[model samples]
Target: MEIPRRLPSQLPLILYLFFIILHTNVATTDTIKVGDWKEILNDTLVQDLGMYAVLRYNNSTGSNLSFYAVFEAQAQTVAGLNFRLALQALDADFPRLYKAYVWEKPWENFKNLTSFEPVLG
Candidate 1:
């Protein structure tokens, strides 16, 4: 089997477009904002979850909303004990599109955390 000679010609153009799109986040994309967490509601005697989060969705329709009460995990005697929660929606007043996500990890692993792109929007 031989590789298509034409495939190489399009490789550079493909990569260039990929990066350009990233630099300029096209419209219709939602952004996530993290809030402060305080007071653990679900205490396990080992880990206390603090709920102080809100997801704000900017709407082109001027019906923006915020989802209150997020998630936070704090632990002792553990090196990696943390997590994040986010709520995403296509628009403020629409019900056809929305998403919720959670990511957990240790404090030391934050450096290796994935970069932001699009979670639910």
Candidate 2:
């Protein structure tokens, strides 16, 4: 078998380009910054999480807040999933916007309502 001498010259550039691309992709996968929440396009599970958050808030605070609907939702993946949901609820027949943050580890069957506050806007 005859070995080609011209192969070595092209191999280095190819390998360098390959590694550059590989590094870029790996870096992109972890580019989730703090407060970089992506919108939940159509996840019913996320909507359900929003409802759970409101219920938990009501139970703990003894506020009679009825869940109306989920307006906007976003999720950030960390050690678990952090769901930030903007939801509409009724308090004494008044519709208001509320922001709820729920952190959950589904595999461990753990969920925590980190924050739930009325959006003052």
Candidate 3:
């Protein structure tokens, strides 16, 4: 029996679809939550490696009292990528009530102060 060959025009489309399907299946959909913040901080390995750090703020006396936590992760390599991914997941899952900013330094040296600033009426 003779075999039929695919035309060159169809190869690109086929490959594109294959990749789309493969990527969709492998894509991570997990998101981080408020509780996960504690876990990330308590991780000794991450701390020792200097891969991640966090800054926390609490207001005891104020009309608009709130607790703010900024999580920082050093993204120098593949592990850093994971750290960033986890951070993003947390942001997506925990929808910050107060202004929250995520930074990747030294590219993003300054915090996004605009979010913290109160909007003037």
Candidate 4:
């Protein structure tokens, strides 16, 4: 007697099992952590009036990064002095992000003029 061959339904089941195994193997493999904001910003373009600094940390579970920037301009007269500061935060993949900008008014006794969301370049 001849043996019966597997039906088309078996093909989908076999493919599903193969994908499950492949995904499991990929998930179990060790993942290297890339957490260095200083290095990341070293290659970035710096603005003429702005200076930037970054701090980063990571562990086996996850990572966090923060960036700070201070922009200053000198004015010969009281009207020309202006200051702007920007701060940003991001995750390892940079999917989740936050940014803030602050303006300083020294004429008004060096008080914070306003705070707003920074526009991304």
Best by TM-score: 2
Give RMSD to native, each candidate. 17.4, 3.2, 12.0, 19.3
lDDT of each structure? 0.35, 0.87, 0.35, 0.39
Candidate 3 residue runs with Cα over 4 Å from true position: 1-3, 7-13, 29-41, 45-121
For candidate 3, lDDT tens digit of each residue in 61-105?
223322223334323222112332122112335424333223333
- Evaluation by TM-score, superior candidate among 3 and 4: 4
| 83 Cα displacement, candidate 4 (Å) | 34
Task: Identify the superior model by lDDT, candidate 2 or candidate 3.
Answer: 2
Worst ten-residue run, lDDT, model 3? 111-120
Give the deviation of candidate 2 from the true structure as CA RMSD.
3.2
Candidate 2, residues 9-103, lDDT tens digits: the string is 99999999999999999988945666578877646786788789889999999999998888788889888889888899999999999989999
Q: State the lDDT at 103 in candidate 3.
A: 34
**Candidate 2 — which residues are off by over 4 angstroms?**
1-4, 19-36
What's the TM for model 1?
0.22
By TM-score rank, best first, the candidates go: 2, 4, 1, 3
- Screening candidate 2 with a backbone cut-off below 3 angstroms (N, C-alpha, C), the clashing residue pairs are none
Per-residue lDDT for 45 in model 1?
22
Q: For model 3, which pairs clash?
A: 32-89, 32-90
**TM-score of every model versus the real structure:** 0.22, 0.77, 0.21, 0.24
What tens-digit string does per-residue lDDT give for candidate 4 at 24-64? 99999854333212111222333322322222122222444
**What is the number of residue pairs that collide in model 3?**
2
